[model samples]
Target: MSHDDLERAGFKDRTRVAEALETVLGAVSGHDRTDRVALGRADGRTLAETVTAPSPVPGYDRAAMDGYAVQAADTFGASDRSPAVLRESDDGAVTPDAAVRVHTGSDLPDGADAVVMIEETETVGDEIEVFDAVAEGENVGDVGEDVAEGTELYDPGHRLRPSDLGLLKSVGVDRVEVYDPPTVGVIPTGEELVQRDPAPGEVIETNGLTVSRLADRWGAVPTYRNVVDDDPNAIRAAIQRDLAKDVVVTTGGSSVGERDHTPEVVDDLGEVLVHGVALKPGHPVALGVVEGTPVIMLPGYPVACIVNAVQFLRPVLKRAGNAPVPDLPTVEAALSRKISSEPGTRTFARVRLREADDGRIAEPTRASGSGVLSSVALADGWVVVPEGREGYDAGDTVAVENWEWSA
Candidate 1:
């Protein structure tokens, strides 16, 4: 590869981040793979089919408190001064003017329409004195109070949580049909990468490990492969081997340099929808599709690779697994210092948050380079600058997004 080749291969115009995301997401179609997992293991899995209650929760009417079951009319107009005297029923049935002993969650006796608290009634030798008036159906847990029969509990693509599992169990759903987690093949390509102790002119691989862990955190099954050299044939073979996966993510060898053979190989294998993006620290990323599998070419720099992976690969996995992608959590804070960024390019400036006398403050990290992994690793969150803005000034209010926070 000569200078002319590099110049020709270089990106003439970078696409906006929003445009690239839309293009990649448009190519992804919903997968049909599903798994019938037990309710105990269904947490964090996306629901594949709509789940409805088979039977109403608490099917039978029961007592809501430890009290005496009595007819509403028997306690009407009763007061502490002149309490309504009623005979205690030896049997569980509550006939007219007869009160039955009942505890919380106990099934309501036949012919009982109301309950009087034990404190409100005084039992004296086969006789009961009701001091409080009660209405029909008062202090009772009605049928289907917690959940109705045939009620829609969860829709397709809804992520199950621990509380959701409890509700499913309450409705007699021991097993649930959930969408299978998307599979991701994480390949790190670089001739200088080494597994063990690196010699001169060699570097240890970290992007593959980081990306694979991120994929697992995002609810995808990731297959982390060994490092591949920057050879066209090797890159093509590695990608072809992982075409069975839902998404293929490769780190390094994606730029326009001579050693960057990933972009060309991906172009030869399939069409490259996006070559570069107008985003800070990750402009050399590429998005393509090879044999209906989405391929994400991330930059070699650790920070850049993480940024591109979160922006591109995370959403792709969510789309393939039929899961909803939500916005990252953010908190409002005041910038302690000014941060500069190129116009028409989005910037993610890492910041450390701290509490101040007035409010929270977001201080930009000292090392703000693409290759400085510690800048992001030690930071609490990042402040995003949109494409339209040049930069943010000191004391400017910004939203610090906590990307590591789980939903």
Candidate 2:
């Protein structure tokens, strides 16, 4: 479209939450790589291929208790009043008239179809008196009972959990092919931004580190580049350098102000697919592609940066890295106070969640301004106020997105 069309489309063309995510992710998918990692280090990594069991768990039919292994028929008539005395065998074998002593997990002796608990038997010299009868297969763990051999244990795209790694080890698997996480480059842009020890008028550059960590949590390898001045040429050079990585993220220069040059810089090098999202606190967000790599531009405010990261960048990395999209925990919370927001924009209201006598309560942090960094740090999570609605009333039950870190 031409500049006039773009201008006419302005903020009123805010992309919905789902559409923005779909658009960003749709453009960044199909970029994952695969690598073989040791089973010990495979936790939290997505499987690149299916894994089948090499061997059945408990490869042998073993005793499930410390008892005597005997033929089920041999103990049928045995009771406390009429005990059946049987000869004991030293070797792991049981005859029709004899029983074999076996401990828990010991392979069931040949000719034994059941185990009689030792507590039910009284030991006499060279013989065991049985008082209870055990049926065939009772208390016996059969071969392949836990996990069958040659079974498809884990499928491609399965994210390994701690127990998943344990299961792999149990199935005799030592190595697995996992999707290599995408490499994300974060560039913080602003002339007034300083890396450390900001003066009174200067702002500290924290978005790069914050976004880098968030990307890392999304299962991507993040590289935080140094702060770049707001100059269009400087931002352009930074973007060009960061294109070496799988995805590039720029913070602070996404707005339409004169100093906000990320959109122009990205457009000069490649194409800006999305210049503005319809989400509040993150409306200035931008999604673009440079040399076939995704480049996401975030708003300068800490809260907006975080919200856009979760709304846009998270999904992109999830697809590009082949990681399963995280379903953030949510809670039904009663709004402690009323929240006011403009119509036509989806708003993310920072909230501090508290458990009260009535129930879980969501107290608004009132940190809608993009520059309100403390609001995000103090919030437990946020509530999404959908577009076309003025706001939510007090005492309204809303779904609050819970932060996994806080939990």
Candidate 3:
């Protein structure tokens, strides 16, 4: 909670920050796999091991078009004024001076020059039909041209898309070994925190549900518990309930408020890797361990909670699942209006994107506060404002990270 803490932690150094992150996660032994699930159900699951293709893509030589396959040199001298004749047999057999009737996927016969397209040449019943000259080999797709056999179809950490699934099915793969998704125990801790189904003065348990949705997005099974009072023992026991799971996320009690017991509870139960992070909206983020399972303590503010969850905690769970980090999609856009922020911590604000005369512009939403949840809900993408800058203004180019781009 002091500048001295920042000095000791060296939060300004990216290498040190990354080192802190790995040290926190390295202590955790990720959850292991058990039963095998069907390919259709393996959408979010990470691949425990590599999945190889049993067969090659485009296993056969297939025609590229409805046009003709011809020996390039055969139609060399034929053109509009000087027409060439293509001989056609009663059986539609093709020869150097002849043509054959072939479908798109039909195999090429041995020692046949080419099947000149009807448009390329004018066929007068049984002539070596030609209107244009041809090269040596044209309109022919060779065997294994699309994909080579025994090549690495997908790797260990590759996430499967619909196209990837189709590729797997095309290559004769029935099943794959995928990492078992870890379970996350989310506890919303605050005396003021109330349940959706509640007593007097109780508000809906929105944070827990939000965390649950995030867990789903990050490919983890979330076991959400009811709102509990700010009691250290109660919180500790609640966390212990999901010992079988991988990571635990607890909201509230991250700051030095009177009832804040998260720090004490974490210290009593396990090691506290970091009591605070040097970031806005989530400066009180507590990275620690409880009984060896990693715990990520987040601030109670709606947008703050959401931002920290994505930029920090999600990566640990993603690695546990053996899934490659989803690319954080960024698009260069200009600011529609001016915006300001303080130095010392990075900030992410949600904004809408629109095409302007010059290029795309990011319009920052006015609803930016710890309590304003609609700001993020209405956001098309997030604008990142780094520490130590005065602010960004209209026409300033910046990278806006989108929620779903490739998806």
User: Top model by TM-score, which number?
Assistant: 1
Instruction: Write down the lDDT that model 2 would get.
Output: 0.85
Tell me, what's the RMSD of every candidate? 2.1, 2.5, 3.9
- Candidate 3 or 1, higher lDDT: 1
lDDT of 1 by residue, 1-407 (tens): 33346458666578999999999999897789998999989999999999999988888898998989988998889999989998888777989889888999999999899888888988888799999999999999998999999999999999999999999999889999999999989999999999889999998898999999999999999999999999999999999999999999999988888798887898889878888899987899999999899999999999999889889998999999999998999999999999888898899999999999999999999425988888888999888899999889999999998877553
TM-score of each: 0.95, 0.91, 0.85
lDDT of each: 0.90, 0.85, 0.70
Estimate, for each residue in 93-165, the C-alpha lDDT of model 2 and write its tens digit: 8888799888999999899999998899989888899998789988799999999999998888788998999
Worst 10 residues of 1 by lDDT: 1-10
For model 1, the superposed segments whose C-alpha errors exceed 4 Å read 1-12
Query: Order of all candidates by TM-score, from best down to worst?
Result: 1, 2, 3
Candidate 3: lDDT over CA atoms? 0.70
Candidate 3: worst-modelled 10 consecutive residues by lDDT: 9-18
Against the correct fold, how does model 1 do in TM-score?
A: 0.95
Over 217-319, each residue of candidate 3 has an lDDT whose tens digit, in order, gives 8787888888878888888887778656788888877766667777667777877777666555566677788777888888788777877777666777776
